[model samples]
Each structure stands twice: as structure tokens, then as C-alpha cells.
Target: MRYSKEHKNQTHARIVKRASVKLRERGAHGIGVADLMKEAGLTHGGFYAHFDSRDALVIEAVTHAMDRSTERWRKLSEETPPEKRLSKIVNSYLAPEHRDNPGQGCAVPALAAEIARESSKTRRVFSGRMEQMIDMLADQYPGLPRKAARKQAMAALATMMGSLVMARVTGNSELSDEILKSGRDAVLERAASSEKKPPRRAATSV
Candidate 1:
């Protein structure tokens, strides 16, 4: 029996979606092609029909994960006031729950270490996703100059990612919590200062 084109497309999408979550939980190498195909309810032979190679599938999966995280951050950002958005994002990103559940959290920080060794194509996708994430963050600051806003966004993102990485690498739960709290406080404090600072003006002759 044969399936319709639409059905094939749907199956392919399902495979990507499933693969995205799996990739987060288990790094790219953690999942075998046959296992992934079976998990997607498709045959291993059909894998090539949907993707040229496992590398292609890995790239697609990473892209999908990035898209999912972006949407989640957007929704969270939209609901909160601009001033509070960074704090909320930091809290959520650095939380123990987010750290423990890689399948449902942001893939960028979760897979950052592994992605360093991935193919150039994969790294490029990751870099593009990071840029989009930064842009989304910059949108939260309405009155700031574009350059200042981007700088602030970069700082906040770096803090959040660094905290999560530290928490994941440390064995002590107390230390993990401290790392998250410190990161959150640092970002919130910095954002508050940014909001308060007056724009710099051209210096006049003394």
C-alpha cells in the first residue's frame, strides 16, 4: 500500500518533531537512526525518503528545537512588562526544573557543548538561532538605542546560559541553586540599572 503526498509530509513533520525532543534529551549521537525511526512510527528504510542523511535530520531537529524555544520565550515575554521580562526569562531558564528536563527546555544551552563538535552546517544553524533569540530579547527594551539593547540582550543571555551550564556540570544541588540565583540576580540588577541610566550626551567644552 502507498500513502498520499500529504500523508508523507505529515509523517516527515512528525519525525522532525519527535527527533527535536529526542535530540534535546539525548544528544545527536545518543539516538540511533533505527530507534528514532521506530519512535516516530516509521520504518528505518523510509528515513532517507524524509531526510538525505542523519546529519540532515540532526540539523532539522536542532532547528525545530530552536523554533520551539523562541516561541515559548516570545509568549512569556508578551505576557510580562518589558522591565520584568528579563528577570522572568532568567528565572525560568536557570530553574532546576528546566535544567532537569532537557526534552522540554531550550536546546541552545542544553546542547551547546556537544554542538561545538558538530558539522559546520549544524553550527551555522545554531548561530542563526542564537541571533534570532537575541533579536527577540532586544524587542523587549523599547526606549533603548539598538546597540545598547543588543548589548543588554547579549549579557542577559550569556548569564542565563552560563548559569545553566554550571548547574548542569556541578554535582551539588546547593551549588546549582546558588549559581542560578546569582545569575538571576545579576541580570535583574543589570536590567534595572539600564532602565534608570540617562542617555549619554555629547560633552560640551569645559
Candidate 2:
């Protein structure tokens, strides 16, 4: 049966959306084209109609997931006070709900390990998205120089990702909660401390 352009576009989007969540739930290699197509309520032969290759689908899926995550973070930043933005993001990222539901949370914590083993093109795309995430966090940082703020964002993101990874790996829920709390406190403390410091004076040649 011949499908209209709109129908094809919608179906393509649906496949990518499902692929995004499933990619998070299953590692990069955990899912195959047939299963993804079945989950999308489409035929496996139709996969190539939407994407040139599985790698293409992977890139698109990761991009979709990261974009969804950033959009949520943008909303949080909008609704939150400038001083509280970082904390809100960190709390959301490290929450038990996010930890337990890998398919719905940020892609970084869910797919970072698997992405490292993907193709160079995939890694480059992920790297670019990671920068976007870092820059989003940096935007909320007031008073600090842009460079310093970006560096701070990088560190905070690393901590959040690592803490969540450890939390998920361990059998202890109590320890996991503690890890989240500690990660939050540490990031917030650093942010608060940075806010208190005076920006360095520019050097003047004598």
C-alpha cells in the first residue's frame, strides 16, 4: 500500500521515538532492527525506508533522547530561580525515579558506556550533544566567568553520571540514595562557594 508523505513522516518519527527509549533501556547492541520495527508496529523491511543503516538509526535515536533531555532541563531552568537551577537539574538527574527508569531519564547516564564503543561518527555526535548539555548547565551559572562556569558544569555532570552509575550497580538502595544526596550536596556546595568568590581582577601591565 502506498502511504502519503505525512503518514510516512509520522511513522518515521514514531520509530525514532521508540528507538530512543528502547536504546536507553537496552544497551546499543541489546536491540536489533527487527525488534525495533516490531515495537514500532512496522515491518522490518521498512526500516531502510526511514534510515540508511542501523548506525543511522542509532545516531538519530541518541540525538532524539538527548534532545528530549535538554528540553526538559531547559524547562526546569526556566521555572527555577537562577540560584536553584543547578540543584534542580542535579536532583532530577540523580533521583531514584530516574535511576530505576533508564528508558525515561537522561541519555548520558544511561548510554555513556555503550556509546564509547560505537562508531567514530556516533561518538562525535554524542560529544556534540554532551557539549550542549554542558552549555545548558553553564547558562544557569551566574557571576562566574563563562569558562569557569563551563568547567563547573562539566564536573557536575561527570559526578552526576558517575554517582548514578554506581548507584545502579550496587545492591544497596540506602547507599544509592546516599550517593545521590552526596552528589547533590557536593555540587551545590561548590556552586555556592563559587558564588561567594570575587571574580579575579584582570591583569594590568605596569
Candidate 3:
């Protein structure tokens, strides 16, 4: 029996959403197309109906995961006072809850390595989404010029992503926690220092 347009759309969404979480939890190549379709409660035969290929599904899944993370950061930044927005984002991202939940957390640390090895089209899509994230982060620093703020955002995001990767891989729980805390503290400190005004030079005699 043929499904209606709405039903088809819904099913497609379900597959993408499930694929997003599974991809993060198990890396890009860890799960096969049949397995993903099975988990989504659909048959492998229907996979082609929604996407042209497994690569297409992967691109869609990566986009979905990154978009969700960006939206989360946007909401956190919106709800916070401008002065505290950066700290709020940094804390929430580096928290233990985010660290322990790979399936629902940021996609960078989870999928960056895999994406680097993907096709050029896939890498381009990932790069575009990453740019959106960096731009959103730069918005939190209204005190700095656009270029300066973007530079700072790049540095801050790199630290957070790198720290998260290390935290997840380290066998020791205490070290993991310490890594999170250090990353959070360092980002906040760097942000604070960047916004400070430089001291005035003493007037020289003529």
C-alpha cells in the first residue's frame, strides 16, 4: 500500500532523527544503512525512497545533529543576560550531563574525525553548519568587533571541542571532570580578558 505525502514526510523525519543520534553514539561507519532503517522501524527497501544513497542519509543526519546543537546554544544565549551569555554557553556545553550524553550532545567532537574522511560534498555541508555555529557564538560577544569576536569564538569553540574529546576518551572519571572544568574556566577567562580595555600610555613631555 502506498503512503500519503504527510506519512512519507513523517517517516523520513523519524529516520533522520534516529540516524542523528546513532551516528553520534557510534561514529559514521559504525552503523549500516539496514541497521539504521531497522532501528527507525522501517525496512531497508524503503531507504532509497527518502534518500538517494547512504551518503545522502549521512549528510542529512549530520546536518540534523549540528542544527539541533546550534538551536540549543541559541536558546541558552537568548535566555541569558548579555554579559553572562558566554559563560552560560561554556558551562552548559562542558557540563557532565553533556559530556556523558554523546548521542545528544555537540556533533563536532563526536563526528569531526569521521567527517574529515567523508566525500567533499559531505565535508562542505559540515563546514557550512560549523560556520553557522561559529557565527552564533560570535554574537555573544557584542563588545568586540566582528573579526575579533569571530577569532575569539573560533579559539573558544576549539578549546571546548578538544577538551570534550579528551574527557570522553580518558579512562579516569576524575580526569574527565577535571578536563571539563578546566576547559570551561579557560574559555571564560579568555573571554573576560579579551573584553578588557588596554591601559592608557603616560603622556610624554614635548
Candidate 1 Cα RMSD (Å) = 1.6
Instruction: Highest lDDT: give the candidate number.
Output: 3
| Better model by lDDT: candidate 2 vs candidate 3 | 3
Off by over 4 Å in 1: none
TM-score each candidate.
0.93, 0.95, 0.95
Count of steric clashes across candidates, in order: 0, 0, 0
- The residue-by-residue lDDT of candidate 3 on 117-143, one tens digit each, is 999999999999999999999998898
Residue pairs clashing in model 3 are none
Tell me the tens digit of each residue's lDDT in model 1 across 55-107: 99999999999998889889998898876776677788879898788898888
Better structure of 1 and 3 per lDDT? 3
Question: lDDT per residue, candidate 2, 64-175, as tens digits?
Answer: 9999989999999899997788889988988888888889888888889889999999999999999999999888787788999999899888988898888888735898
